[model samples]
Target: MEIRRLAGRVRTAIARADQKLVTFVQSHANLTTALVTAGLALWALSTHQSAIVLRMAAAGAVGYFLGLTPAVCVGALSVGFSVAISLEHGFSISNLIIEVIGAGCSAWLGYQHKMQKVRQEQAADPHAPQVLPWAVVNEIRTSLAAIRFLLFPLHDEEGSRENQALQQATQELSRLEALFREMEQRDRAGEGR
Candidate 1:
């Protein structure tokens, strides 16, 4: 019990610290980006690290933190400085490729972040499409399917009033299922974007 309590306290402390860090980053985005970029520059220049992955990650991080403009600026700066350093030694085709790839990563990640923010804003609007929880929607669909089966035991009749009503009910259910399917597809497409 004592150990569990201590662990709980530690978890709470860690959570609080994480929240504080996120708050600071959000509130001081420019400062955070500048600081991170400066660190990246120092690390890259001092070590003369030509690791394309490192460049890409640094640029992407800065891009994800801000919007396209800052990301593009960071990408350009990083690529230009790295290329200059490479040129000082001799023109290396590999280094140029790495720099270009890093710049691309920066642009792509930044654009993604900006689009994500826009999506969040749209989701918050009442006019946006209603998105039900996927699992719950699936369960509802399953239940509807079971009810449909139960309603039409053997065969669907066209003439009898009772069967006609059941047929109409089945048609409505089918339409509802199609609607949910469409919604699911839309949700997936949105995520892929």
Candidate 2:
């Protein structure tokens, strides 16, 4: 009974720790990525593991491109440096090829991961506008162009009726843009909460 109780307590502690860890990672994703990359690079270098170094570099490049984490650059650079060191010992074309292939695959996977995350966010908040739909943006642009063309003759006049009308149209467009921006900000704030 004592052993069982002790095991139960241990399991509870582990569960709490895991929850905390998840929260920490979510809150400090960038820092976590950087630290993990550094640790991996250090391990690979210390072990003289060329494959590990190459894979890390590739993964880093992918993450960097996807804007997933800035630390990916550090990982890629560290791996490159490690590979150079290995080259000093013995130059192997096979190792270089592996590095290239690993980097390519990692980048592809990172891009896919980024797209998936974006899709998930959109699904979670259907009302939140991730981007202005192309058609709407194009319509706005067309309206602005028409307004400009119509008001071209009044460009030099400051107090004329045509000039005032032009200013009003421009202001209206600005207000619309501001409204979209405000909605996006509110959506982001809601997500944070």
Candidate 3:
């Protein structure tokens, strides 16, 4: 009986800790999004170039939702912004095909990297539930995956942090799951008797 009570207390403690971490992640994500939106809005107002403004705004919006790799979004936006500036200054593209190819290649690379990160995170936390309504596990996985994309193909600072948080989340989730399962089993067994 004491052992069971101790296990219950431990599970409760882990659940509370996980909830706090999840809250922190959510708060940080909201802050990041707000900052991106405000920055893009300000940039849009200051830029005389309408095309550049739109590109920045779109990229910033994507970055905000991605919650990771704001740099990649910024880099992509810069490329398009530079092209726009060049066009405005009378740089003509001789081959539209080449420009399209370049844009497509960059987008493909970004997408592929994002998918690979998702796979890695999934592999790392295989037992974790994929679709829990109350748990922010999927969001955590997504954020971590995107961070992995931003950090690779090298050591990822944000990815490491995300991984740690994800592991904690999974451990907490497992504890809760086990606790509930045990309770359900006990109740069913008593009913049968």
Candidate 4:
């Protein structure tokens, strides 16, 4: 019964955590979108300026922190803007290609960092113990609860009569059910007083 109560509380807590995760992802998306737009606007307004370069850098950093994946949209935009500026600065096309490659590598590194953090969290969070889903848990419990027969050697069955005794014991299921009801009633009455 205590485990049942704990399970109910864990279910509620997990639901709340799921909602928080959704909100967190949405907010990250919005922020990333805003940063990307700002970087593009800056690049369009001033094709060659330190301010544009700084904005591009900021966008790349934010993208790495928020995306949690390589080839993120903001990361792509950052690299795109940087390449365009390099082209405008009279850099060779090869240099622009190198910039894109560097950007890609950095994005991949950021993704790896995010994955490491996730693994660390999983290791540290004991209360978030890994378990089978509810359906699997229910199936296991059901199968165990319905286990009415135990395999026994023929000698044990006849010499000690353990198998027959176990079968007889299983027949006391109704009595156990009544005892459970009585306990429940007593608990309710105690609570009322």
What are the root-mean-square deviations of the candidates from the true structure over C-alphas? Answer: 12.2, 15.9, 27.4, 19.2
- Candidate 2 versus truth, CA RMSD in Å, comes to 15.9
The number of the candidate with the highest lDDT is: 1
| Model 3 RMSD in angstroms | 27.4
Taking all chains together, each candidate's TM-score versus the true structure is 0.36, 0.34, 0.26, 0.36
lDDT of each: 0.69, 0.65, 0.55, 0.58
- The 10-residue segment of model 3 with minimum total lDDT is 95-104
Angstrom error at residue 156, model 4: 17
For model 1, the run of ten residues with the poorest summed lDDT: 32-41
Q: Tens digit of lDDT per residue, candidate 4, span 1-193?
A: 9999999999999999999999998757545644554554454456544544444445446546776343456656766776677776675665345344444444544555567678899889855434446874675465445544333333444545775656655655555566557766876796699
What residue pairs clash in candidate 3, if any at all? none
Clash list (residue pairs), candidate 2: 58-103, 62-107
Report the alpha-carbon TM-score of model 1 versus the true structure: 0.36
Candidate 4: TM-score? Answer: 0.36
Which of the predicted structures, 3 or 4, would earn the higher lDDT when compared with the native?
4
**Higher lDDT: candidate 1 or 3?**
1
| Per-model tally of clashing residue pairs | 0, 2, 0, 0
Provide the global lDDT of candidate 4 against the true structure: 0.58
